[model samples]
Target: MITKYKLYFLTLVVSLLLLGCASKQNFIDKSKSITKETYTYHTFENKNKLQLDFYQSINYKNTKPLILYVHGGGFSGGARDENYIKNYCSKMAKNGFAVASISYRLTMKKLGFGCNTEASLKKEAFIKASEDISYATKYLIDNKKKFNIDTTKIILVGSSAGAEAILNLAYVYENKILAKEFKYAGVIAMAGAITSIEKISTKRAIPTLLFHGTKDKLVPYNVAPHHYCKKNKKGYLQLYGSKAIANKLKELNTSYNLYTIQNGNHSWNSKPMFVYFREMISFIDHQVLQSKYQQKEVVKKISDYTSTDL
Candidate 1:
């Protein structure tokens, strides 16, 4: 026995809920329509092989932006073909970008060692992963004509351990001679961190988008030893999380966006992939594709400031 006004209010609430559901379902349908192409991108001398799976929209009209996605599994497990990753990449592809999901060497075999050995192995793994990503990027750029990739619009997206790798790839490895031919458009790190803030220099900084749950235990939301190992532990690798890296970027006057998920955990991919994907696409559109920050301008500013002070 509801009043007419009460019944009207209830009807409006139900209508909104139904509309929300319809919208979400439409998004899912759009993601499902993207087409994918797979290729073996690289192989190592050790017989370890890495591959890339590319996703693009059927209606893509021009050279598409590139998203090189790295999967996460504690630097040990995970593959480029993981359904969640594939689906996420497909969704991004549907949004008019070419998404490449890549596989890299993992180091779970050497995990049980004491602190020093563990830390050393972890460091080696990070380096290897970063190197692999560099190779993957090179592979794409070298064959951009075949893949229809816009070389100037490459983005790195990684999750957890993969996140760590891409952050190092973007900030650490890019600073080296090995990446001389590479130019990153932006980096998106999900539950990721870096070995040191010192690795990130003002001149080498790129637009960054970060997503971290404050309660992430494995990867610190702030700063901590890799895997949250105790300070006195033998294998403790110092790592700086999104907040720390963002602060450093702020000091350098670099463009960066940090989204801190309240009470969020490390299993971000477990949630509906599109939720974050939408935000990520927005970041890419605004920060990378439409960004006003240019490499030449940054270098010029640094040069001018140095001369003025001198």
Candidate 2:
């Protein structure tokens, strides 16, 4: 009952399926060399354990810089196992850095404080996330020996809401007892903002690298509401975007590098992953790894500046 054409079609289908499976397997196998381990960084009162996934390169001999990557989900729903996060972390590991993707407490549904304004609610969400980041940092520091982490070269890398949290952790909370314990080498904020520029100070300044799309609607490229709503709008808080932060750093005579994607939307990572990665690695090399902190006045617009110029 089998015609030649039917048999040929069936054979082709099977071949395609086999090829697809082989490609998938190959992809998985390629990343298998990067060892992954999970650890409980925090335990909430409800017995929920916050965990982080750390990726380490097997071939690297000496201790490596630690990069704590925070996923962005608008403060609601992202995970350490997200494909993008995993892939980014894996690439970072291969580049001779120990990378960790973390799961922090989210505040998407409701504000922690009852009967609070939109701005206050947003602030509370950021504060909660920052607290989690702090705890995760402490956990890593405590287990630095086990993870072979170079405490002197620790960097916080975050995207969107996660970026907001790390910015707060690095600047706003710097005076706090918990934050003072650790001296971070640098911070990478992708499409992130802060509630106020007052959080940034000369004494607590650290070299920062920022990547933001000019037309980002969710988080402003310049400055806008927390979710890009109008000022004083209900359920939305005003925020200072990367541009503002860079300007503040410039005013304080601190070191910072800003990358702007002209006419690009919020998903700059999708198309420019390699570009951002190269710039970030270069920043780490010069600003953090090489210990270069030239606090020159940032004259031109950040978009006009190149990585080499920084």
Candidate 1 lDDT over residue span 28-79, tens digit each: 4645558777887787788777788888876665677799999888776878
Candidate 2: RMSD to truth: 12.9
Question: How many steric clashes between backbone atoms does each model show?
Answer: 2, 0
For 23-109, candidate 2 gives per-residue lDDT tens digits of 221443565568889989899889999999999878665667899988887776777788767777777775668988999887865
* Candidate 2 Cα misplacement greater than 4 A, ranges: 1-28, 110-117, 174-179, 269-272, 294-310
lDDT for model 2: 0.74
Pairs with steric clashes in candidate 1? 115-234, 115-235
TM-score of 1: 0.81
Worst 10 residues of 1 by lDDT: 294-303
